[model samples]
Target: DTAVSQTPKYLVTQMGNDKSIKCEQNLGHDTMYWYKQDSKKFLKIMFSYNNKELIINETVPNRFSPKSPDKAHLNLHINSLELGDSAVYFCASSQVAGGLADTQYFGPGTRLTVL
Candidate 1:
């Protein structure tokens, strides 16, 4: 069974369009994170949620937003997507121990193509 999963594994959209990616975890973790991997495969943290509360918000543009309805779900919403937004978005969940994340489980990733 997949512990972490994301919907619409592949996303193709035009520039300026808005999109959203849904993620869920069954591991019962209190913390969830969103990471963006650019074409060069450089992964950067975008957002983090702990028990449905925003804990860490990276320097991403305001157009990008992370929403968590509950502890098991973390969703990413992008408004007015740009060409630079074309990349793979990954969702991960982990249990924080001693102020650090432990044994993170990552989703398959959602590839967004902006043309």
Candidate 2:
């Protein structure tokens, strides 16, 4: 079973198209997240949701939205996808921090290319 899973390992589209990446965690984790790794390999936290607590990192664009219907799933929807939005999107999860550091487990990754 996949701890965290995302579909469409790769995506290619025009500059103004819209797309979405779906995520799910079978680990029964209470927290799930979305991260984007740019061409420079800089992994940045985009959005985090745990029990309805949504923590969004400021650097993420307004055109990007994260939807979490339950504790085990978080999906990312991009609007008016621009060339700059082209990057590797990763879905991650943690059991919820209570004692030690949270180790985010990542999915295979979805490479979105805006051509």
Candidate 3:
């Protein structure tokens, strides 16, 4: 069984549109994260939620938002999508270890294309 899953594995949209992607994890972990992988293959953390509380990355734009209704699910919403926003989005989950989060278990990414 998959530990983490994302909906709409592939998304194609036009610029200035809005989109949302959903994620769910069955690992029973308390911490979850959203990451973006650019065309150059650089992966960066966009947001993280621990026990449903938000921790956003400073570099992430305001257009990107993460919402966790509960510990097992985290969803991403992007407003006014831009061409530069086209990338592969990944969801990951992990548990705390020694006062810090442990290794993350990632979901199959959702590839978003903006035209």
Task: Tell me the whole-model lDDT of each prediction, alpha carbons only.
Answer: 0.89, 0.87, 0.90
lDDT of 1 by residue, 2-97 (tens): 999998899999999999999999998888989999989998888888865675555799999998888889999999999999999999988882
Model 3 residue 9 distance off true place after TM-score fit, in angstroms: 0.5
Best by lDDT: 3
TM-score of each: 0.92, 0.93, 0.94
Q: List RMSD in Å for every model shown.
A: 1.6, 1.8, 1.8
lDDT of 3 by residue, 80-114 (tens): 99999999999998887212347899999999999
- Which lDDT tens digits does candidate 2 get at residues 61-114? 889999887777899999998988989999989886422277788899999999
Better of 1 and 3 by TM-score: 3
Per model, state how many residue pairs clash.
Answer: 0, 0, 0
- Point out the worst 10-residue segment of candidate 3 by lDDT: 94-103
Query: What are the clashing pairs of model 2?
Result: none
